[model samples]
Target: MNIHQLDINHLKSLETPFYHYDMELLANTLDAAKKAADKRGFHLHYALKANFNDRILELIQSKGYGADCVSGNEVQKSIDMGFPASQITFAGVGKSDKEIILALEQQIFAFNVESIQELLIIDELAGKLGVKANISLRINPNVDAHTHHYITTGLDENKFGVPNSELEKAASVLRSCEHVNLLGLHFHVGSQITDMNVFKSLCVKVNEWKNWFEERGTTIKVLNVGGGLGVDYQQPDENPMPDFEAYFDVFDKFLERNPNQEVHFELGRALVAQSGTLVSQVLYTKSGIKKNFLILDAGMTELMRPALYQAYHKIEKLGSSNQEELLNYDVVGPICESSDCFGKEVTLPISERGDLIAIRTAGAYGEVMASRYNLRDEIRYVYG
Candidate 1:
């Protein structure tokens, strides 16, 4: 269910400027995604970078999904949340010595090694620990995700995976690292991706690279096509859940792999975006000769996507008034910066002081990216 279906009186009484998570929707989303992946013998790993709320992780773990972590603490959090170490895959461009050591000690599934240098470091750390580290080469496939430039990750210029030009060098380095065991390949183009053709193109790149390694007598066991599925930010109610069937169908139809190979996905946003909403109370309303404004207690400090990436989120005024006139209002936050605006010319009903507002489709990056920039109260969450 969308935020509009929530009990207005209940939300209004507790607080303003807090996250409201619909746990039922989250469960339904997870069930749908898992069913689709399991039907195709594909493994799913929840990317903890999306929303690492304790309860969210607990519910996700209860579904028997793996953990895709990018930080040392995330790895530990997954462990603490009861995600098996063997189901955890640690991936990032720069892995500090401490992080690498932690992952090694935990014996995570594999490290999606980005560069030849990182491979060497993992090997050194693993050697000191007297253990072999399983690693998957994170390859830069150069496929454009057709997303925001800041989020695009697979291009040759991106600071992520090892580019094609360096594969030969990486292979040579891999052969020398006695403590590092090569398992497979990993590719992540970008996030908030909406196009299906992008996945088809990625399959072509994965095929080319997979064959390139097998030709050299390398036995590839895992093919991790990292997730970039986008949710409907414009129309959350219309498309509450991403089409898991269609998404998995793209890979199952196009990707070529050995019978023994295992496919993995690192999904974050698609599974949780629709289940979250940012609720706030309108503090005041202002009218200028040119524009109207609805000042809210919530700011970029509460939901930073609109300012950080120019992201779009549908805004809804709670407690519908059948006779209230619809008017354009620029929704803004109390943050000091001028960029703290949430939406410009946002159309809403006649609003007033203490009017409730719901910022839809904020479940993914909203609360997780919040800051205490203005010494704002620690973000709170309400689940139903």
Candidate 2:
């Protein structure tokens, strides 16, 4: 069933200011992505940073997808959650010596190295542990992802991967490091990228980098073009599966590959965003001379995207009979900060005290980023 239909029955039972996740919808979305990736013989790794809920991780792991972790805790969590260490890939900019030691001890598949210094650190750590650490260089392809400036990471100005000019030096450093095994190359442009041209551009950049390495007598075995596929926030119902077919097709057509090379992707939001919603209740509806305000019990502490990025999510009233009565409202939450508002001048059905409200498309970065600010307690979560 759709969100509105599920809301009719579940809204009454749920406590206010909670997260609601539709497991069926999430399963379908995962299936679609898996099917598309399997068609091209591509490996998919679920980026745990998107939503690290144990239940979500269990479902994703059950689907045969690997885990992409960025921290020591995440690597441990992935292993604890039944994901094989052999299917896990650790990635980050500043990996601590402790983290490197842990991964080497765990024997994870590979480490997505971001800099030459980090590679040296890993090599040293692996040497101390008497292990050969598998590594993949995270190269900054210098391509514009054209997403939100805050989330964009591939640009030369960003503090993410090794610069394009440093590849030779990085490779030379890897060659001398006896404890580290250089596996391949990894490129992640940015996040929430809707434009397919960005992926196509990334493919071109990957091909260029591959040829550069090949010409230097280096054989790249794995090509990991990182994931930033965006979902439809305006109309979740109209486009639930996130156009995985088109996303994978772009890489299939543009990315150049060798016979021994394997392609991999790390996706997070496109898999879990649409499956969850932030459910809250309207605490009060105040009418002023200027405009109406619908105050909610949930605030930025529960879902901060609105205040952080001025992002939009479809706000709907649950179990409302007056759907046609149009009224403008500045939806806000009970937080000390004025910036804790969800939407301004939003049109919704005539609202009242205790009316249930659901913020759509909050599954990815919503609850995972929640804070205990304003002395607020954690919200409950319901899975269906």
Candidate 3:
């Protein structure tokens, strides 16, 4: 089913704001990404931080995708939803000691270690449990992914990974840790990266590190090039597939791999962003001397991307006929915060009160980030 059939007519009857997911579209996207990865024998792990709704997780698990979790709860959630523990890779910069112990109890496939301290912590916890915790050191290659500074993680300034200067020291510490088994290396440049050249640069960095590890008589078995593939928010239809072929092709070409080495990816947004839409109704339209405002019932409370990332989502009226009349409107929400505006100078068909507004490409960082700020009503959902 499409957006037109997602109970938009009865949307107002249920609630003022909620997220609607196109399951068919999401499945197709998963299939597309999975097929691309499978062609090159690359493993695809769905980044649960993107969208962890139980229904979404179930479908993704059904498609044979592993779970890339950042917390203990996410690992439990994935396991509860039928994802295999052997397929789960726990990753985070600040995992708590309790979280580490929980993962050790579950025997997760690997922990993406961000720092040497974290590696020692994991070793201590694993020693307590009398089990070797498999781990992959997250390396900061200092490659500029050319994305937003806030989202760019591989740079030297970011606190997400261990810098190149610390790699040998981290490796030395890992070798001395008796309870931790060094699995391989992992690198994540940033999120919403649209440029293929950034990934090509990342591949070059991965190759250099792989050789570095091999030179030390340590073979890197798993090379996890973390996912930051950007989706086309401007033109969803024209580039819906998200260039997975090109993304996997880069690794297939530039990444030097051993016969037994397995390449893995942790994809989040590109798999689910276009498959969902946050459908809301325009409560009022007020024109002022300075600007016209479309007051939406769904604020950043429902979809926080606009407020948090200053991100853009194409907004369209569901049944409006005045498509040709262009007008500038600051799409505002009922949230009391001044920063709750979705977009400034957003061009939409002349909208009116009670007209449905569909926020396109909200499937990824949309509803999962919703909150009850301003004592707002509970958000709902309609799956197609």
- Give the least accurate 10-residue stretch of model 1, judged by summed lDDT: 1-10
By TM-score, the best candidate is 1
For all predictions, the C-alpha RMSD in Å is 0.8, 1.2, 1.3
What lDDT tens digits, residue by residue, belong to model 3 across residues 184-292? 8999999999888998899999999999989999978899999999999987656665988888898899888899899999999999999888888899999999999
Q: CA shift at 69, candidate 1, in angstroms?
A: 0.5
lDDT of each: 0.94, 0.91, 0.89
Candidate 1, lDDT over the whole model: 0.94
Clashes (N, CA, C under 3 Å) per candidate: 0, 0, 0
Where does candidate 2 stray beyond 4 Å?
Answer: 7-10
Candidate 3 lDDT: 0.89
lDDT for each residue of candidate 1 in 95-155, tens digit (9 for 90 to 100): 8999999999999999999999999999999999999999999999999999999899999
lDDT (10s digit) by residue, model 2, range 1-384 = 456777466576667898888899999999999999999999999999899998899999999999999999999999999999988999999889888898999999999999999999999889888999999999999989898888898999999999988988998998899998878899999999999999999999999999998998988989999999998898887877698999999999999999968999999999999999998999999999998999999999999999998888989887777646989899999999989999999989898997899899999999889999988998788888
Give model 3's TM-score versus the native structure. 0.97
| Alpha-carbon TM-score of each model against the true structure | 0.99, 0.97, 0.97
**Residue 65 error, candidate 3, Å:** 0.5
Shift of residue 104 alpha carbon in model 1, Å: 0.6
